[model samples]
Target chain A: MRATEMTPNDKTNDSTEQKIFDAAHELFVQKGLDGAKMQEIADRAGINKALLHYYYRTKDKLYEMVAKSIIHQGIPIIQKTIESDLPLEEKIIKFVDFYIDLIRRNPFIPLFIISEMNKHPEQFIEKILPARLPRPEIFLKQVEDAVAAGTIRPVNPQHLLLNIISLCVFPFVARPIMQMVLGMQKTEADQFLKQRKTEVTEFIFAALRPR
Target chain B: MRATEMTPNDKTNDSTEQKIFDAAHELFVQKGLDGAKMQEIADRAGINKALLHYYYRTKDKLYEMVAKSIIHQGIPIIQKTIESDLPLEEKIIKFVDFYIDLIRRNPFIPLFIISEMNKHPEQFIEKILPARLPRPEIFLKQVEDAVAAGTIRPVNPQHLLLNIISLCVFPFVARPIMQMVLGMQKTEADQFLKQRKTEVTEFIFAALRPR
Candidate 1:
């Protein structure tokens, strides 16, 4: 567990809100929705339960906020990279690099997303989807262009999209299982992913290159 | 859902074990580890919970038996494909076809593995993960052969393996989300997966071909 740099740019309002979110996120990650209690969140925040409810209103609302916030960690950057006018190869490099860094920053996000998504996927995906997420069309168009230019063999945009996502996300999503399989400690896993950023992009290009 | 085929001669101890497995599987899949009660499993089995315990002593034990039964749905076949002397292209087709059919028959397996593994990953993986569950060396050898034979481009076996698992598993892991995102029903999702089974192999092959 890395210590987050705690700066005091905190206005009174922002400080309280940050405290609440910090506490809530920790509990949510550890205990999940059914198991985590409101009182525990308030206690962890060092605030009264009344105050916790005053800010977040309900557990579902608090969770929705957390899910949306966590999803934003990787989603916006991936969207921006996808929308960028970069070449197909560079796009792959940038996306994987961005994700490796994001996972490094918040180690819990992928598992949190998958577990919660498992619990109520319809509600979660409706709130945010990769298709409606940001700039996937840009990515789809790039793949189409790459195939047209004979830079790669023909592929569906969805397959291209899923391939990138799976390669980048699976190690993290299955980190617990991976830690055992790879015989990696937490620090080593971080290093592995950092190395994997480049490894994945090269692998993707190798697979997609014209025969 | 498809009807399972059987011959009377083939249905000896296989069907008896299969009956217990089928009954136990329904309970575990629908209810999850902690949520599933032994009495419920036995009741579903049309026997006493004591009888259930006689077959599999502890709750964790039952979960493992069920998990092992489910993993046999596809993984051994995948490992076999990775180790086969077939060309990499045929191997990819074999794998994709296997996974699509595997998931189609047992939609709950991936979620079951992930969720149970999430709860006690070390135990689950230790109990279930083979000395190598789809070893990299085998896949790497195949990739090396393909690259050597000019059938495919260079790639890391590990990254490709992870990507392949993700493509096959994520759709089901995100089934509830996909159902909503595509405005799909069970039938629609089935059709969607069926379509992907055919196209996914081609897409991956296209991606793997040399530039």
Candidate 2:
């Protein structure tokens, strides 16, 4: 939200600002904050250096915008899905579906974040995530209620959430290693992920089904 | 094995080779292959540059040795553990236990591998992993047997293995983000991992248990 939220208040200003942002996002994800140059971002955006600077004054500012943009686009969807009023099974399917789709679309986000976090831990830990991050409590309560109603076996919601996240995220993060180990090419890897939408949902459902 | 494999016949030669290797390992991990320097490694090992070169010949050779050493140390342990004659539940537990412990002790390995693999995919995919990487067939067959015996519900073993691995590995790979989300300090993160050894194994068992 903060990503799109930081907009100038005019129609042309918004489009130019967005172009600058789009260019920054590509470069930052590919080359990282330290490796990316402001001049390169300007050229990529088809804007002059003065105009790019006018929009986002510093490289760090642009990098922060890109990070916030990515996290905003990705994490909130899961939080909103998890917090929705759908039944537990449907809610979880949606979560896995959206989370996997997001990762598939933005495969670079994880490595970029990990690399940047190592470079700027205090910024990520102290500033960005803490600002508007969603809590897992809503999903936790849902799990607890499901168990209380005997719709599912009693389980720790934290562990379950962590499991769901791990399943969805790890394949993307460890793709190279997993690809080598599984003997999957890129097309095969995509097919595997397609199957995972249902595979992961059912896997969790089977685990949670009462004895 | 490969990390310390390229050694001369003499004991003194072996120790010096190992010392050079130990120094190379630390530097390559911290600075990566491109960033690491032979002189720094020599300095770190308390050996002369001539000796380091005599052992490794070049940084690439040293990097290959380090990567092999790490993969050799880290991965085969899991493969050997899974292939042992333990029952399904116990085998899964051993996996989660050994895996989480391995990542905990060698926190840099995942990030380093991912980064290095990105840098040198041809080497890793074409050369390294193919040499002795474990197949998931044993685990897959074990799951099939469990299902046929009515000890567990029918499941795709590949998906199951991927889920199990994702649960175990993602926490370490995405620690910074997870740590911020969970609001955990270093000690709490360690405590959380300790709990996951049990939590993940049981979570999987609960899913696998026959209806």
Candidate 3:
């Protein structure tokens, strides 16, 4: 529910170019960069290879566009949440809530980006960050403010941010293992995730509360 | 550090068959099942195609063996940890410690298993679990005992397990993104992970402590 304010642009639902973009995104995320094929993406999009090339002349270009699109859809929300005027506790809760929802919707995105990024770090840094880079400074300052106010125990801001991000995002990213370990059916797992909205917020707050 | 108690059988390090197994594992994990080639695996192992076939007849057979080996190596350690008689808090800390070490050593294993499981869930359950399945009862009992004793808050054991696994394993699985978001160079990220041995334990303890 905390994610209501932010809406990710789902290109799959939009225009012809967006359909091509969305199809490419799905293929790349599911099959990875090397495994993904431009012809397959075109076929999936129900478009000719010529038109697919018209929108994206190369596989690399399509991959970069999808990565940038994903980053643009998700990172700015985090940047804005932390950069907002909300208090630390509220901001942290909002951040976690929004992120869990985002990842739930785009389960493969974090893995897709991370795998592709490691394979092509230089390309990702050059392509993605310039498009819509995350502002860690905004988040770091909020953590610092919370620590300063004795609202939370002293911890490195980066670690704290990483902790929050990990807790919110990992379940979605690692859903298969989670389902196995938790022994839940898909619908059951969905219900469990719904419960995490409050459970995760409370857990983070409890961890951060000054002793 | 705690993982010293449990060692994953490195079939990779033992015999000619193992070299094939290890090489196949590396290719399959990195490139995935469809993207991996039997001949390429033979080349990576410095062995002949016929010899590779002599060890494992088919790609499907080889993939299953690798999956079983990975599950056998990792899942039992978790089962043992939860089944241990340590006090709840100490047990939780030890579980976290062992898992972080495990994932730190084999960063891609989690992503590999999860991705592969999503693609071939039935095959994994039939092949991997029958070999060395995790027993959730031990973990559930421990959590129930802790709750009954007022040692921790009354949270669902499955959720708690998911949270612990997420907090411990996620940073390593999503290392590229973690490095980018936290702005850490590879060495710096390694150092940060070292610190998580303590930081993650403390955070979990803080969250679970009875209020």
Q: Quote the lDDT for A102 in model 3.
A: 80
The count of residue-pair clashes in candidate 2 stands at 1
Question: Which prediction has the highest TM-score against the true structure?
Answer: 3
Local accuracy of candidate 2 as per-residue lDDT tens digits, B1-211: 2233445455474588878888999887765665578999999999899887777777777888888778788877888887777888888988889898998899878787886686567877665553777777778899999889998888888788888988888777777777767777889887887788788887888888777
Q: Which CAPRI level is candidate 3?
A: medium
Tell me which residue pairs clash in candidate 2. A207-B207
**Model 2 chain B worst lDDT window (10 residues):** B1-10
Which candidate should be chosen as best, given lDDT against the real structure?
A: 2
**Candidates, DockQ:** 0.33, 0.49, 0.49
What are the clashing pairs of model 3?
none
Chain A TM-score of candidate 3 vs. true chain A: 0.85
Which residue pairs show collisions in model 1?
A: A207-B207, A207-B208, A208-B207, A209-B210, A209-B211, A210-B210, A210-B211, A211-B210
lDDT of 1 by residue, B39-121 (tens): 77777767766666565667777778677767765667766876787766777788888877878788877766766677666
User: Where does candidate 1 stray beyond 4 Å?
Assistant: A1-20, A35-58, A84-90, A122-132, A145-151, A179-189, B1-24, B34-65, B85-89, B126-136, B145-152, B175-189
User: Candidates 1 and 3: which is better by TM-score?
Assistant: 3
Question: Can you write out model 2's per-residue Cα lDDT over A72-172, one digit (the tens) per residue?
Answer: 77777877887787877888988898988988888878787776676567776665553766677778889999999999988888778888988887887
